[model samples]
Target: MNSIRANPQAGLDIHMLDVQFIRDNLEAVKANCKNRNVTADVDRVVALDEQRRQILQQQQVHQHRQNEISKLIPKEKDKDKKQALIQEGRDLREKVAALENQVKEVEAELKTVLMTIPNMSHPDAPVGLTPADNKVISKVGEPKKFDFKPKDHVALAEALDIVDFEAGSSVAGQKFYFLKNEAVLLELALVQYAFGKLLEKGYTPIITPDVAKVDVLEGIGFMPRGPETQIYSLANTDLCLIATAEITLGGMHRDRIFDELDLPIKYVGMSHCFRTEAGAPGRDTRGLYRVHQFTKVEMFVFCTPDQSDGLHQELLAIEESIFQGLGLPYHVIDTCTGDLGGPAYRKFDIETWMPARGEAGEYGEVTSTSNCTDFQSRRLGIRFKSTKQKGTRFVHTLNGTAVAVSRALVAILENYQQADGSVVIPEALKRWVGRDVISRKGGISG
Candidate 1:
C-alpha cells in the first residue's frame, strides 16, 4: 500500500453555524455549546471573525488604490510622475497581499473554532450530561419470558455452527466474524426485509460505495482523521472506509441545488460499514454487539427546513415499524443534548431488548435518527431554490438506521431463542430466508 499524503486542509470548506449567526446570537450559541458539553472558544471565534473582516476590508481598499495608481501610470506624460505612480502601485499590491494572507490565517482559525461548536439543540430536547438523562418517549412490545436460561448470540451461534468467529479472526483480526449457514441467509433476509419496507415508503433504494473521500466525511460531520475517530482511513490515500451508509448517502448530492418542487428527497441505502471502534475500550466487545465491520441499511433525506422536523419524526416512525415487523421489543429515546454530537439538532434512538446482554437482559441501541437542520448541508453545499423565494437556502439533512445487521442479529438470536437450542426467524424475513427456524443440524423447518 503506497501511502500518498494529501493536504488534510485542502478540501475543508466547512461553513457551519453561519459566522453572522454566531455573532448576532452569541449568548445563545455559547449556551448551546455549554449544553452540548463542547469546549469551543466562542469569544475567540467572534474576535477572529472580526479580524478577518477588517483585514478583508483593508485588502479591498488597497486593491482599489492600486487600480487607481495603475490607471494614472499609463496616462502620465512625465516619466518621474509615472515612475512614482508605478512605485505606489507596487507598494499597494504588497500591502494587499499581506492583508489577504492575514485574512486567510484568521479565517482558518475561525473555522477551526467554529467546528468545535455543536448545532443548537431542539427546545424540547432534554439538557443532560449522560445517556441516563435521555428521555424515554415510548416502549413498544414486551420482552419475551424464557422458561430456559437464555443464551447470548455468541453461544447460540456456536451451538448452531452458524457464525465462524475463529475463521474470521484468522483471516482478518479481532472484532471480525463471518456468518455461515442460516446466519448468511438471515443477514440477506434482513436487508431485503428492510429495503422492502423503505421502498413502500417511497424511498429510492441504493447500494452505496463502502469508501469515501476524507472531505466527504468531514462535510458529513465525521472526524475522519483523529485520535478519537471511528472511521478507518485507507493506507496512503485520501479515502476512508465509511462508518455507515449515512456518509455516502449524504455526500451523494454534495454541492447540489434542488428546485422547491423537489423539496424532499429520501433514500434507503445499503452498504458495508467499517469502524475502528477506537477509544471504546472493554465495552460490548463480546460477540457482534460492537464490531469492526457490518452491513447496514441506512435512510437519508434532504429537505427544506420546514420539512425536516416532520421528516425526522417520519424517519423515527419508519425505524419503529421496521423493528416492529421483526417482533422485537424496543423503546424510543429522545437523546439528550450532550449526546447529540456536533451536527444533530435533535436525535432519537431505539434500543432493542437483548435477552443476553446482562445477568438477564438489557436494551441495546439498535437504531437512531437525527435532524441535522442545515448543519451538514451548509458544509456540503447542498442547497435548494424556491420559485417564490429569491436565493438558495441550505437543505436540512437527516439519517436513520433501518437495520445494523450485527446488532439486529444479536437481538434476534437472543430474543427468539427456543429452549431446544433453535432460533426462530421473524415472519417478515421468512420469504427471503426460505425458512421459519434454524436448528443445530443446520436444518430449516416450518
Candidate 2:
C-alpha cells in the first residue's frame, strides 16, 4: 500500500486533483470509492493535508522571525548583540528548511493516497459488480450460423501454418508467437483498415513509441511498477514497455495548453503493445485471444468537458463501423461501476462473437471506449482556453481501441474459414491482403 514514489518529481502527473477538492468533497469521494469497490483512505488525505498546511505556516513564521532578526542586526552596534542575532537568524533558517522537507513528505504521502481513489462514475452508469450486471446497450450484427463444423483460430492457424507458437516459446517465452504467412498480412491489413477509417473521421494518425517513462504510464492510469502490474519494466531504468498506444499518445500533450478553436483534438495511434500477462492464466489464453505482445491501433481524443460524452459515443460508433465493415457480429455493453477501473467516468466495451471461445461460441471483448472526463488531462496538465472563456480548463480525454490486430485476426480467421480448409478474407481487408482466400497450404499463393 505504500506506493510513495522515490523520485523527487514523483507527484507531477499522479497528483492532479486539488487537495481542496478532496477536503470539500470527502463524503462524495468516499461514496465513489464505495461504489467502485476501491479502498482509498479519504480521511488520510485530509489529515495529512492538515499537517502539510501546519508545516507551511510554521515555516512562514520562522522565515518572518529570521527576516526581522537580520534587519535588527544591521542597526545593532554591539558586537555581541549583532553576533547573537546572526546566530539566531542561522538557526531559524535551519528550522525553516527542516519544516519545508516535512511539508514535502506530507504532501507526497497525501498525493499517493489521493491518486488511489478512482474517478467519479457517471450517474447514468448502472451500479453492479460483475459481467451479468452490465447493461446490453445493443447487439450490432447477428451471430453467424455455420453449415460446416467450424474450427477455432488455433486449428485454422495450424492448418494454414500462419502462426508458430512452439518456435515463439523457444525464443521469447509463453504467450508469445510469430504471426506467419497470411496472419502477418492480416495483422497489417487490420492496422491499415483501422487507420484509414480513423483518418477519414478527422483523426490525426501517429506511430507511438513502444516504451514510455514510468510516470507517463502512471498518468494514463496504468501501474508501471508494482506486484500486480501488467507492465514490463527495464532493468535499472525508468522506462516500461507500453501496454497500449494510450500511454504514449496521452503523454505527448503533457503540460500543454491548447486553444479552444483547437478543441477536440483526435489522434489515432498505432503501436506494438506489450504486457506481462502476469496473472492471465485462463480459458481465454487459447491463442491470439490473449498474448504478451500485439499490434494495436488506438483512438485518443482531447475535447472540452461538454464534448466528452458525445465524443465517447463517436468513438464507439467508429469501433462498430470497423467491425461491421469486416462483417463481424458483435455486441455493445455499458460497463458497470465495479468493472469500470480507474480514470474512466463511463465505459463501453465491444465484444465480438468468436465461434470457438467455449463449447459453443461466446463473445470476447475486442475494443473498449471510455469517457475519462479530465481525469487524464488533469494528470498530464493538458488544458484548453477559448476566446470567449476567461481561464484555461482541463480538456476531457477519451481513448478507444480502433483494432486489436490479434483478436481481430481471431475473429476473421474463425468466422471466414471454409469447409475446404481455406479461409476467406473479410471484404475490409481484401485490398491490403490482396486475393480473397488464405489457402490450406503454407503461404497465400495462387
Models, CA RMSD each: 4.3, 3.3
Candidate 1 local lDDT, 373-434, one digit each (tens): 98898888888999999988889999999999999999999999999989999988999998
List runs of model 1 lying over 4 Å from the truth.
1-14, 67-84, 443-446
- Mark the regions of model 2 whose C-alpha exceeds 4 Å error after superposition: 1-16, 64-85, 388-390
Pairs in clash, predicted candidate 1:
3-236
Q: Candidate 2 residues 1-446, lDDT tens each?
A: 11232221334433545567878988988887888888989898889978877877777788889889988998999999989999999899899878878877886787789778888889999888777878989997877888988899999898899999888888998889999988988989899999999989999999999999998888888877768899999889999999999999999998788998988899999999998887776746678888999999999999999999999999999999999999999999999998899999999999999988788898889999999898887777788988897988888999999999989988988888888778999987999988789987545564
- Considering every candidate listed, which one attains the maximal TM-score? 1
* lDDT against true structure, model 1: 0.89
How many Å off is the CA of 424 in candidate 1?
0.6
Clashes of each: 1, 0
Estimated TM-score per prediction? Answer: 0.94, 0.92
